[model samples]
Target chain A: MARATGCLAVSLGTALQICLLFGTASLLSVGGGNSVVPEIQLRAVDTYHWLSAAQFGDLFAIAQAAPGPSMLLVTLVGYKAGGVVGALLATVAMILPAGVIVHVVARFWQSSSGARWHVAMERGLAPVAIGLVAASGAIIARTTEHSPAQLALTAAATLVLCATKLNPLFLVAAAGIAGWLGLV
Target chain B: MSRDRPSSDVSLGRLAATFCQIALASFGGGLSAWSRKVVVEDRGWMTDEEFLSAMTLCRVLPGANQVNLAIYVGSKLRGPRGAVAAVLGLIAVPVLIVLVLGYLYFRNGSVPATQSILRGITAVAVAMTFAMAYKTGAKALRSLPAWVLCAASFLLSAVFRVPLPVMLAIVAPVALWWAWPARPDASP
Candidate 1:
């Protein structure tokens, strides 16, 4: 009886913690979800000790393989920590605050398209945004890269994507086949 | 710039399903490209310029840029209900798949075969990201100020290890000042 009650208490606490942590991440994702990856890692792996660093890495791989938003990682984290309820809480918490912010900004942006400041903002910030996108790619590359073979694959893929009209999903499939065959 | 705007006749369910189809198709990254293809080209929801600007705004706002984009398009089409349908449709399947993957991983433990498949997929995934960055960066690099900002941002955030927010704070002010709206008398 005591153990049952203790289990319930622990699960509830874990659920709440997931909500708070993910809620913070929701607001802090300034340059999209990737921007807050490190923070999310720290809290889930280091602070909470809910999962090991290795587990986090595996989860990341799984999230990448699955479809939808890359931010599905939060759902995985919440599931590991607290079960189904925790997963729901974490997913909702991760997206809701930012969703609200986005809706408000969208409304403002729709109305202010021709405003001078809006024009300036649209023009000025574009490069900065592009640069950030570039930086994110580089960061992801540095982390995943292992061998010269992998680097070559990346370069070839980039060229193919930029130079051809080939569908990207086919390229991804080819790469996956290579991996499955132990080629790449 | 005015072409046919999105028809007001687009039902809420269709809006949800369209976004869902996009989600299904976006196997890799580059949701923006697929978004443009579907919303701008196929559906004639908005002009390309409108989509690009909305995409830029979405990138800055918190949350997943694509998710925000769905909301932006949804709201533009059908008010608050539009947002609900779009977001729900976008995330529902992905969330389910992710949870299932999570379950399987822990249940079976790490298998060498699964890792192999994931690594391959991930390698291509990373490459897709590289292509996207290059494609977009090429466009931004057309202007000198934009190019300079791009190079500086890449160096600081990727190479020097400065955090994203800090890097943005350092570079954004300068970039924005350079690109600020021109005053009539100040024009050279």
Candidate 2:
């Protein structure tokens, strides 16, 4: 772990920047991790030139395939910007603010467990959150799927996932094999 | 079945270890399901009702849902230090794994050999995002108003490229109004 981060010389300025970017993103990432993905892509890929859009997509794949949260994409983006230090900083910043908020609210949540507005808020926000989730998918699709074969594969995978209870890792693994074989 | 508060005697090591197991078990998505299984079923740290409510609260808050959940569970059982320990446990190994993968990726600089495989995997990952939307939308978009809200949000972010704050500013009020309980004290 130390050697991996040691590969790059991390600077204070870069550390600060990574912290600022991901910390703000953590709070704004209402709905879930995917909600902030487009913004992170915009900053990390377009503004900062830390990585290519394709690389961002690739990292997203790796994060998804890996264990833990898909939000680990933020770590990859940080790594591109500042190496291992950037990765750790980004992950911490991404979770800290939101983590604090949840910690504080969790206290209030216990007390307000059955409040009427609470139920209303829950029902009311569900559709909106679902929409944001779909938008994230659309954004990712735009970034990742270019070739006809890739696009078709994405569509097919989506269909399979929606129609069946089959685990997604199988789809990802099969797709990787297909790619390795140059089938897609 | 026990609706009373759980004992706070759980050690920090146990909290961390449980979450570590949950994180490792949650590869390829389904972190939430894994968390419920472990926290509510296996460990009995929280009852079904408490876990379900905490799940909703975690989602409703701003952080990554799973991370926020870890915080909630940790704090509930062991206060702030427990929260830190649980989160570290949840992410420690995974962070190392991701960093190693990332190092290999950057070092190779997109070799043609692995490019094809990554391309294939990227497609499935993208599909997973859409599948999540569909699964959630199926339950949430049963009514016309819900569909309208869902579509509006999709268009705003996906097509118009609106920032999140602005998008929520436009749609959230209307959604809350539509969803507010008709009776102030009616049974759910």
Q: TM-score: which candidate is best?
A: 1
After superposition, the stretches of candidate 1 with alpha carbons farther than 4 Å from their true spots are A1-17, A34-57, B1-10, B26-56, B137-140, B183-188
lDDT of 2 by residue, A74-156 (tens): 98889888888789899999999999999888877655756877766667767777676677677767876678999999899
Q: Which pairs clash (backbone N, Cα, C closer than 3 Å) in model 1?
A: none
User: Which run of 10 residues does model 1 chain A get worst, by summed lDDT?
Assistant: A1-10
- Tens-place lDDT per residue, model 2, B17-83, is 9899988866545566567657865687875446645765676679888898999999888888989
lDDT of 1 by residue, A5-92 (tens): 1122346677778989999999999878988889999999899987889989888777765678889899888888876666778899
RMSD of each: 4.4, 5.9
Best by lDDT, which number? 2
> How high is the DockQ of candidate 2?
0.49
